[model samples]
Target: MQSQWGIMHGTHTTPVGRVRDGALDLLKWLALLSMVLDHLRYVGLSLDGLYVPGRLAFPWFCLAIAANLHRTRNAVVTGHWRYLGWLLLFSVISEVPYRMFIDDADTLNVLPTLALGLLVARGWQQKALIDRGLALIALILGAVFSSQLMFGFFGVLLPLAMLLVFRRPWYFSVLPGWVCVAANQWQILLNSGSVVALTGLVACLIAPLAGLMLLQYAKNVSPPAMRRWAYALYPLHFLLLLLLRKALA
Candidate 1:
């Protein structure tokens, strides 16, 4: 855990030679922006169009987690636990605001889904007994309570699948994209000819590939590194948005 704590700090303050990943920072910012815009739809305005961009939020976030995990391959054991702890803590803290702001939340907050995704991703990467055991536990829980999770079974699997093809060819992302669509419970619409179906498929496929492009080609463009403090924004944004709703009323 001391090692992870060092990582927690090293993320914000790195050595001179440790060049920060600008594109990764950009993707994190993008995820945060998409989340805010998506929630704006509920602010009682004609913001339905925000939904499409909002759909970009989760997949990018999942990729960011996977990418970070990959970069710190040495710290998977400690890092994942620390990561899971933060997500679980915020999952509890954010639920009230999430439920308050959304009003139609039928499931737990997104953190639990992300937490389980972390476990799944790690399990796939390592064959250790502890890793597989924990992954199996999360799998059963995620499965039995599918409807109660933010994205359900496939959602829990999306991060693991994305981790599998993280730096592979862009075309490979389509595999996890399918998993994403399934996670969203919109697989039935995949073969349909509707506008929403196309939008869903496009967002699923593009979100991850776009993040990969940022990672591979946007190296020179420096973006602010997203650190631990960013987690505060999740619940804080809910309160801010809630205040906006009050003002609007």
Candidate 2:
């Protein structure tokens, strides 16, 4: 199956001198913006309406992960380990800020979910038994701790779904799109039936496909790269928001 990005099946050739993808950076920035908007709802303001756009954040982030895995499909294992390591490190580092900011937080911060999702996506892309085993373990953990995961089990599945349709037709993204909705508690949104809740539901349903379109067609116009240091932003944002909330009070 050939794609516009030249994805060849059963090809083991590593890309040479791979340049950074600006579209990915753009996606990351947009995701970060959406996340900030979502978190802003907690800033002692009556901004509940922001929830609609906020629905886009997590799915876009999962798309970024899928893009990264697709790009590094043939890279060395050490590099993949490094990626997972940063996520794990920040998962621990970010917990305090996450708890401090979020009221009665029931779930771990989002990074652990992403880290597990990464393992699952890697399992799908790789032929290694260890990778597959790790992915299985991740799935089990996601299942066992669904209540303790920010987006729950479906969130852990979203990245793998994104990876499956990464370079495929745009319509294929609906799989992950629905997964995104499920992860965000679509049933509750549906039950609410308010305009904002409905809008948020729609946003969650389409976010993955929309993000995929951006990745496929958006120009790589030298957007800022989101690197390892970007991990700090997750925890830092929570702290900043806590300060903002306190100041507003």
Quick one: best TM-score, which candidate?
Answer: 2
Model 2 has an lDDT value of: 0.87
Error of 2 at 213 (Å): 1.1
Decoy 2 TM-score against native: 0.94
TM-scores for every predicted model? 0.87, 0.94
- lDDT per residue, candidate 1, 137-224, as tens digits? 8888889999999989888988887787754555777788878777765756566657766786678767766766666667677778
lDDT at 100, model 2: 97
All candidates: CA RMSD in angstroms? 6.5, 2.4
Highest lDDT: which candidate? 2
C-alpha local distance difference test of each model? 0.79, 0.87
